[model samples]
Target: DEYLERESFETSYFSTVAAAQEALDKHTAASAARDNQSVTGSSAFSEHWDILIIHMVTSKLDSHTMRDWETERNHIKSIPTLEEFNSFLKNRADLLETMEEAQSQKHTRRHSDISHNRPKTFVLIPTTRINCEALNIPSHIKLADPTFSVPAEVHMLLGADLFWAVLSNNRINLGKNKPTLVETTLGWIVSGSIQVPYSKHNKMQSYNTVHCHFLNNIELEEKLDKFFEFESVSTTQQSRTKGESECEQIFTQTTTRHPDGNFIVTIPLKESPECLGDSSQQALIQFKSLERKFNRNSEFKQKYTDFLEEYQTLGHMSENTNPQDDKTSYIMPHHGILREDKLTTKLRTVFNASSITSSGKSFNDIQYIGPTVQDDLLSILIRFRQHKYVVSSDIEKMYRQIYVKEEQRSLQQIYWRSDPSEPIKLYKLNRVAYGTASAPYLATRCLMQLGQECTDKNVGETILHDFYVDDYISGNDDEQTLIQTCQNSPTEFMGEKC
Candidate 1:
């Protein structure tokens, strides 16, 4: 509400105007009552004089004061009044009507100007997946068995009609239940209900339902005809044997290549050859198939390993920095130390010490500088001589956990500047956060407070842990002690088995 008051001038002006109008009415009424039953010409003059005085005083006042007067005048005018008061209201209404007429004219003119300035027409181009598919040639394709040569031609003609229907209305009905070929194929592929054939020869080219539909589509054939003028036809000969019939060679001319470079090829074979007789032959074929599958798997694994090695090597080389700067450097405090008298009183009492750590002493105090300082400190401390077997733990989403103090919330607000047309907005911090320079110091202070509590409780005698934001590394002499310390800490490590 406070922010709303700041942004809207009309709201403030309306409130002030209302109050001023109320005050004027009260003054008018009091003056009229004082001059009651008096027929002197001075009575009318006195009333007008009082009204004029009120208006003058209100006009000279600040916006809030003027609004208060307006509010008072409006309140008093609501009551049954003298003839002269009614006449005054009628005149004021006429003035308001004139102002409103002028405002309405201005608004209409502005609206007309805006409407004329806007774009006359806009074309919305298709970009989404569904819209793109609607405009695509592949979506109109249909597939059939490659060996069915006679039916394939018939299918092509039917597919052309279906494609036209889809293009006209963006949908079609094939029968009582079946819809367009594109819809059926999309349903199968998207739902993962169709079994797609995996090809080891070409990973990029696999026989899926989508590919099957695309290949048989009439629109795709038309596109190929336009671009490539494909031609030529060829056939392969295959021999087949049947029961009680001597093994006879059949010269089957099965493949046909279209004029647009698109081909319709066929291979003569039983749908499931293993379903035939001869158990020993089927076993031998199965073993050979397994061997081929193993070979393909091994080849894929080797290629993947080579790719990983190259990727890691390139990543490391890119990140390689000068050794000297990588080493941690100690930083001195920027501000002067607390005075000896203040420190003796505050620190000595707080720490319950016989003597406070003296100021300006290099051994007693130090600070870490730079963005990577915390990471460096954690690494060095984990490897320190006094402790070993460090187990690192992290508070899940720690920045979102800590609450901001109510009084200091505004101090944490960030003003975000967007486009020029939109005003800058303030984002109030609802929780502790990163990215701000002061957040790290604030988080560290919170951790210190928690540490002080733990020390007071005297829990986990041999364990030593230090926290930096969400991350914590607890060190002990052995693995068991470190594990125990982690169990005692109030945190869930990544919500997994800790």
Candidate 2:
């Protein structure tokens, strides 16, 4: 019985699609005429889609339903405002949800073996109606529930193939993965629906849903490389004159090398360490926040101490020498309580290289944001969303895991004190500090190298392709395969295991 209802919904959806296609064919001449009048896309939609967009936007002019083509294109000739059209889409999405729920109830009555009272989960694929209708991809729209509500003008110029590619990929991905989501999300007991965002969606409890997105046939890396040429050295200087910012020049001149060849920047020497502006006070605030949290959870306090001990053992930080005339020392400002839930200052009082200094030069101003070697995030997300089973974890203290040569440690100085009366003690970070301009590039480059060195070929490939910084998000058809892949990774003596 449930199968029959699903089949009927799919049939209805395809029938509507056919109706749209026919309407487009009939109005091809009218659509071609619209070319001179500036349509939605920079390039006009191929003659057919232009007509279909108009029909979707103005479907109600002559009749409530489009049984056949409207005699005159006059009905939908006037374009609706983006807001007005969006409202229509919301109404459409709600209507579909209502229909789906009604059908589910009907199916429940006939299927005696299955529980009808299970929670419902929905994966939203909301876009404008035109995005669904006019965009071409020979995908058969299954009418279980679709929630498109974007502006009509936006969809008018969109191509059919692009639209079809996006929608089909998401549908196919969700169809493959739905069974994998069980237990905690109540997937074992609940039926999932694909939808557009609806108003009543927030009211439901015990609802667990994840979005699926389009994965293009072409690799993202290839597409990005083709679009944005990143092979050359690009400078940030924009025709500098008399008083134009010379921070870049200062940074280059001040940039030095340790005996071990690690690049180092000495604070308050060639490059002056900057104050954190309003954020400077955060150090005090974060200290108090931690103090307060310690009073509440002693266990958390223990974790914090253990974390610090682990950090020191990793050689990420250590005590600094006495203040000397030749040595440049800067009081690193700590703020925002280095917290999650409460204060978890990953670094208590670390040099804030990002802060704007008195000379109006920030540490970030001097550094080169090295060439981007990472994959596009959208590409990763889309690919990740497509699988039946997915595993996402983070590498503990990613930046700290890598070592900074001893000679370069002075560049990342900090000030810390146990109490207000206690004299602040100076320290030097022995590893790459967070909030530095090059941290992301440096860390990701190392990660890619690690991926290359990994023994498990499949895991190595996934590490290179799916990781976004410390976060590892990847998908597979089987859970055990994913676990095995992780176990084979080259994570020896990991300080903070993800």
Best by TM-score: 2
Please, what are the lDDT tens digits per residue for candidate 1 over residues 1-498? 533332244334544554554555455445544444343346555545545444443354455334433444554534323434433433332222222112231123232210001111132211111212222224444433222111122222223224334332233333332223333322211211122224576333221222122245667557645543333111111111241011011101433333432222221222222222222232234334434443556643344334324423532112122223322211111111123466222111011011112222221112111121132342334344346576666665454445543332332232222222465333334444344333454444334434433433434112223555556654767889777767866443212211
Q: Which stretches in model 2 have alpha-carbon errors above 4 Å?
A: 1-310, 325-327, 336-351, 419-422, 453-456, 489-498
TM-score of 1: 0.21
How does candidate 1 score on lDDT? Answer: 0.33
Error of 1 at 404 (Å): 2.3
lDDT for each residue of candidate 2 in 1-498, tens digit (9 for 90 to 100): 545665456445644654554454334424433532455554546444445554554553333222222322223344433333333333233222222122242333353231111111232323323233322323453332233223211111113334223332132223421311112211111124333334565442222333222223436535544534443211111122322224334334555444543344422223333322222344344456666676777666665556555756766678766545324333345432344544445434344566554555555555545544455565567667667788787777777755654554655565554444676566677777777776676667667655655666765677677788888788777889866756654353121221
Q: Which structure among the candidates has the greatest lDDT? A: 2
